[model samples]
Target: MRYLLYALTLLLSSSLLFFVQPMVAKMVTPVLGGSPAVWNTCMVFFQALLLGGYVYAHASTRWLGTRRQSLVHLAVMIVGVLFLPIGFEPPTDATSLENPALWLLGALFLGVGWPFFVISTSAPLLQKWFSTTDHPDAADPYHLYAASNVGSFFGLVAYPFLIEPRIGVQAQTTLWMICYVVLIAAVAGCALALWRSAEPEAAASEASPPAAVLPLSWGRRGRWVLWAFIPSSMMLAVTSFVTTDIAPVPMLWIPPLAIYLLSFVLVFARVEWFRSLPVFTLFPLTLLGLGAMLFVQLGSPLEWVAGIHFLGLLIISLVFHGLMAADRPATRHLTEFFCWMSVGGALGGVFNALLAPLIFDRLLDYPALLVIAALAFPPALYSRRAVQITLLIGAALAGYLVGRDVMIYLGLERSRELATLAAVALSLGIPTVIAFTRARVLTPALLSVPLLISTFYLGQPEGNELHAERSFFAANQVVKTPDGGYHKLYNGTTLHGVQAQDDEFRLVPLSYYYLTGPLGQLFEVLSKRPERHPFAVVGLGTGAIAAYTHRGQEADFFEIDQAIARIARDPRYFTYLEDCPGECEVILGDGRLQLAQMPDERYELIVLDAYSSTAIPVHLLTLEAVEMYLKKLTPDGILAFHISNRHLDLQPPLTRIAGELGLVVRGRDHWVDANDPVYNLYVDGSDWVMMAKNEEAFGAIIDHPSWHEYKPEPRLRVWTDDYANIFDAYILDF
Candidate 1:
């Protein structure tokens, strides 16, 4: 009964710890304007707090008696419950966009900091408490840690699927408070068991075990930190890579994190589950596979790309975590072991989440960590001569590829594709041969040299020329078309906007903003009015919409990223802003917050084009946002939403919100023909939603065969500031 009580206590506390992360982050999205970086910043705070909790557990267990340890922990738990009803109240001064990360941290710390800190101490502290008891499971209390992680995994999965879809944020908070109360009772029960088992001899035996089999050394502690750090960093790096470069599905963070937690469960529950031999074998194969796909641009399906990266991350995590578990100290030093592990985890989070963004120009951290992971695993061969020879050969091959790339850049060679294929082959083949034949200590270094070179090759201009820049928001790139007639802007792998470079058609809007596109049609109808209408664009991507402004018109662009604004304004990269006939103003801040401060009905049209990399900013689509937009528009002004996302079906939510707001919503899907004269020059497929207060204003466009009135799905719930479920908005078939 005592063992069961301890198990339940740890499990419940772990579950709540994971559950509160996503819940609180979702609650605070509106305050931060829904940047993916917000989640990364939250992770840094959580990791730091976790390290603090581990330190507390270590100190209390080392100094206090068993009963005293339990009593102190119970007291802390009671104090933590005082801050319960978990929710964030945005700061009165949060409107400032000077440092959003720090503001977000402050909001999260005040809201759920104490509860999270108290729960973090549970697994290590309870495992120590159980070690002192006379229960049958006392000798090997590590399984309880596994049980704790099992709860964590389920808790994370539950938020997006079971809890979020069914309950509003308020109800979710209430449910969590109920669980916290139950966890308290379980903790008290464990304390009672500790008090009952306090016999003199048993206490003495528990207090001081037999002499240490092997004294703890600094070298061993350093190993513990290294093993823990690799996987922690990898988890964040993979999350950033996939969301920014692959697809920006908000829930993609879950899989890598869940796999990371499951690594701990598997290693602690049964070491045999992750054998070092097989893990080492599969590690190189998967690494080579990922490198090939990244460099070759084989155009593999998105699912396949996601699968390879995710599976590779899982395998790498298992190997590193399994190493840590194998070298764990005796139960007498368990808390100290966990404390150092937490320190390492916090360091990893700091490096990837905080330092990388400020210091590096691009995502150098992801590939840098890949090199570290290779070094973390054991070398396959250790021949001195073989190592030296392999290094020489690898360097020569890398040098040749670099020289060839330079030649291609200078227009001295027309074999760019041939050179790329050669580089890809060397990148994959060299790593495999080294892993198989002469796995030397410098194998990872040799492997890294080629892989880094491959990054430069893969990132080279596939068009006429390429220029890239990295900012706090994302990696931005401008590529001139092969014909040197158009320039395109990209955010990660997704195209944001395009402009023709030819003097004759330089003013034409290309890509999704083509003259015949949905946005184009709306602009045409609005332009028919005699008055010069003031327009506000929420996102300024190459300033494509600026081309539609007439001589008497003016457009104000609210762009969050200064790098994007700079790129759009530069005539060398794009001419839309410079070529515009009307006045243009760029406002740098969160679009929603900036718009709220504007005068009522200040604009004739407001376009919400801020969906970055297919990740919909949910805060901008809620009922509260719709009300705010309406307040900022003229009586008959239209609010246009570019809802062209591959993963989400956003039309239903817009339709539902429009119905509740007593507004008329119309939509059109524009698809250009391949044989059309302007297909690649100025047109692409697009879907847009236009909502307005006057139904008569939409009658002309709605009557066209291409446009239709949007209908709300009966089963879909209206999204508001208090509640939203994105799972319901996902397009499964896409």
Candidate 2:
């Protein structure tokens, strides 16, 4: 019963820690763009807080003694109750908008900072407290660490699959507050148990454990930090690659985090056989396979790529965490071990989330860390000279193929891409096989391959790149089309919008925003209708939609990224905004926030083109958001959403929301052939959905061949700010 009290406290506290992350992110969705940076910033804040908690635990246990520390912790817990039911209030200043990550960090701190700090202290502090108790399992309190992660894993998995689909974000916060109060009582119970059950000998052994221990050195501490750092960085990197680069599956970040927590669960659970597993052998081989896939597209299904990378992350995390777990110090140093681990974890977040964007033009941190992690595999595998000779011969053959491709790079863009693929294949495949055969002999060679490859681009993306910049929001690029006939804007790999470079076609909308596209078709209908106030565009992508506005008319483009706004206004990259026949202004803020302030402007048309790089701005798609948009529109105004995506079927949930709002929705799955007689249109396929109060609101476009009444499947549910299921909307294109 006494041990159960300790476990229960760990469970509730860790659950609160993990649950509040997504709940706060959901609250954050409206205030920020759908940037991966937002998630990482939140992680950095939580990780920093965790380190602070560990510091408090280590200091208090040394100064106040175990029994007295518990009394002090109880006081801290009671004071934390003042910050309940976390809420967000976004900043309105123009300067704060430039670097949203800084603003987001401050806002999250104010909302959940105190309660989270209290929760963070529980894991290590309780484990330390448990180690001094008379309970039989108290000697190895690491098992409680597993229990804490179980709570973490459960909370993370539960938010999307169970809590989010069923309850709203607002209610989730209230429930979280209630659970937090219960946790305080559980923690109080543990304190009473510790004070009552601690023996005289246990008190004397406070400074040292029963077992003999070596002196803790700086080198030993550094190793612990490195071990913890790899997994922390790998988890975020894998998430970015899988969702943005490989494929954007909704709720995809869960598996990597789940695996991360599970690594702790396996190691700290003290599963004896796990220690003997051949993780070092599996780590390099998995890296080899994933590196091949990363450099060369095999035309494999999305599931295949996702599966291999996920497997690599699992093996790599186990190897890193396993090393630190094996060297865990005596029970007396329990809190100290965790404190160092938190420091490493916090550093990893800072590197990937904050520093990497400032330092690199591309997401190069992932591959660079992989090479660093490979160096940690203990060199237990070796082979004879004969095996080494044979592997070297195989590597020579692969090099020959890579050279042949490189020789053809002067031919065309396709040839250059093929050459790059060959080089990567040689780098990843040959070294991987050679290392696995004689790991120690080729380990240095293996490390050099990825470092060289990741540091320089071999022209893999296949375009005449004109401009590139990395921001906390995302990596933005402006590149000329292969034909050199058009300029394109890209956020990561996803093309945001495009414009023809020719002076004759400069004002004409191209790509998905072309005259024949769904957005243009909606505009065609709007052009004939009585005009309302200037239309509002949620996403400002090269200002392509500005072409639709007539002379003397006005249009407002709400752009969240200041960098993107700058690009659209710059004549060198794109001239859509400059060529606008109407009065145009780019408002620098999140679309919803900017629109909320414009209560008097009754826009006749509102276009939601905010989705970039498959990062769905789910806050904009919910029932509450739709209601807000409707309120901002004229009596018969139209709400248009650019639903064009390669990985997600976004229309289903919107159809469900239409039913909930009792609004009429029409859609068009429009595609323009590149080889059309009017090829200069430079258009591509697009999907758009527009909703109105009734049939009369749409005018003549409703009866057009491209427009249809789109409906949702029976299982699809209306998305509100409180509840959304990306899984239901995820397209099984793989």
Candidate 3:
């Protein structure tokens, strides 16, 4: 019963710590540009606070002793509880948006730092306190860490699936307050129970048997930090890449974090046979399989690609953490060990969130971190000359693949058959090398040499890029087509906009806003509107919508990313903003926040292009946002939405929002045939949704065959500021 109490305290603290992460991220997304980096930056802040808490735990245990520290912790918990129901709003001014990462860090520090720091201390401090108790496995309280992670896993898994779908943030906070109050009592009960049995030190001599304790060195401590750092960095990198590139599933960030926590649970459990693996013998297999994904494309499903990489994450965590656990210090130095572990985690967050973006122009952090992970694991398998020979052969095979790119670089004519042969060679060679590389005779240092070489081969930046830039928000590029006929703009993996380079088509819109698309037709339908009110575009993707502005009209473009705004205005890449017939003003800030500040009934037409395939300004599509848009629109004005998602089916949510607000909505899934002459100018298929106060506001387009009325499902609730679930809208693209 006493052990159960200790475990439950650790579990509850961990649950609260993790559950608040995604919830707070959701709150701050609209303010921080809604870039994927928002999550990474938030992680760095939490990891730093967690490290501070661990330091406090270690210092208090040595100086204050268990009895005095327990009283102080109770007081600290009371103080932390005062900062309950954590929440914040988007800053009102544009000054905070100028340095969003630091502003976000400062905001989070004020909002949730105290409670997070207090909760982080519970795991290390409670486990250390339990070690002095008279429980059977008190000497090996590492299992308590496993139970803590079990609770963490539950917290992450529950938020997207169970909590966010049904409960609003306010209600979730209320429930959290109830759970926390229960936890405070549970902790107080633990202190009383410990005192009732005996004083903290009275049973320590009996509970902790005498054993030979080794002296700690900086070198040994560093090994622990490295073990923790690789997994932490890899978790962020994997989540960033997979969410943007591979699966693009809704709530995709959850699985990577879940894998991270589950790895800790599997590594620290007391069952030796299940917890420990011959990691050195199996790690190369995981690495080679992951490497093959870069070179070979056998048309595997998106889920399978994401799964293989996630499996790699799990295996890498197990190997590194398993070794870290095996090197655990005696019970006296346990708190110090955990303190260093938190240091590694904080550094990992800094590297991925702060440093990597500045250092690399492209998304190369994942493969670089993979190389580091390969070298960090100790090679324990045994082999001789045969393994070295096999590795050399594999290196030669990779060289052959590299040679093909060199041939292209050097202006040699390459055949299609040769490309297929090189890919097949790489796919076959990776597994062959993995089989022999597991032997103990080979060193990991030698293994990283080929991977380092392959990073150069497989991870080079794209070619024909006329402009490449990145911001805290996202990485973007402007590339010329191989034929030099058009320029394309890409935001990460999603196409943002495009423009034709030829004089005949220079001023024409392309890609999603091509002259033949639904947007073009909508503009044609609204061409006869009285030229009194101005126009507003939420996102400034290459400023393509500016082409719709007439000589007497005005258009306001709200763009969050400064780099994107610059590229959109640059005539070399895109000229829509420059060549517009009327005035074009670029307002630099979040679209929703900027829109909320404008006067009511201000615009005749409002266009929303703030969504991508996966990452989106979720706050922009809610009931409150729609209501705000309605207030900004004239009685006969129309709202246009670019709903071109490859994964999420957002129509149902918009339909429900329309039903609740008594608005009319219609959409077109426009498919353009490549056989058309417009295809030569870079026109593509697009999906668009348009809404209005009534069918009369849509004018003639409402009756056109290209547009269909949206059907609302009574089962689907309208999304609001407090409740919106992307998981419910996820569509299986593969």
Index of the highest-TM-score prediction: 3
Against the true structure, candidate 3 reaches a TM-score of 0.92
Local accuracy of candidate 1 as per-residue lDDT tens digits, 102-197: 777787889999999999998898888888777656756777888899888888888888999888888999999999988988999989998887
Stretches of candidate 1 off by over 4 Å are 91-95, 199-214, 297-300, 380-443, 446-450, 458-467, 482-484, 502-504, 612-614, 732-734
Give per-residue lDDT, candidate 1, residue 229. 92
Rate residue 453 of model 3 by lDDT.
Answer: 50
**Candidate 2 structure quality by residue, lDDT tens digits, 1-734:** 98777887898889888988877877886777567777778888989999999999999998998899999999998988888878888777556777777888889889999999989999899998988887777667777998999999899888888898788778898999899889989988998898898463664444443222666899889988988998998888777667666665546767888888888877777675443456555565555455545545332477777888788888888877877777777777888999999999999888888888888776666676776775655544322343344345435644664676667654556645545674657545864676566446566455446434543442244488888887777778899877888899888777888888889988988878878768777788788876546799999988999999988888999988888898899999999999889999998887887888887537888999975355788888888889889988888899999888877878889988998888898998876667786655567788888899988889888798768998666677778777877776766576
Give per-candidate clash totals: 1, 2, 6
TM-score of each: 0.89, 0.91, 0.92
Query: Against the correct fold, how does model 1 do in TM-score?
Result: 0.89
RMSD of 1: 4.4
Question: What's model 3's lDDT at 57?
Answer: 93
Clashing pairs in 2: 168-722, 169-722
Candidate 3 residues 1-734, lDDT tens each? 98899888888888888898898888888686456689889989989998999999999988987667888888898887888878786787877788788989999999888888888898889887777666667676878999999889988888888889889888988888777778788878777665655534544533332221545889888988998899999999888877766645537777888898988888788755433555444576566556555544222477788888888899888877777777777777879989999999899999998998888765667778878987777655323343354455555656666566667755532343344445455546654666655555345665565555545544444546798776787778888887888788888778888887787777788889876689888888778776557889988988888888888788999988888899998888898899888799999888888998999998988999977543777789999999999899988888998878777777888888988988899999987788988677678888888999989888889899989998888888778888887765656564
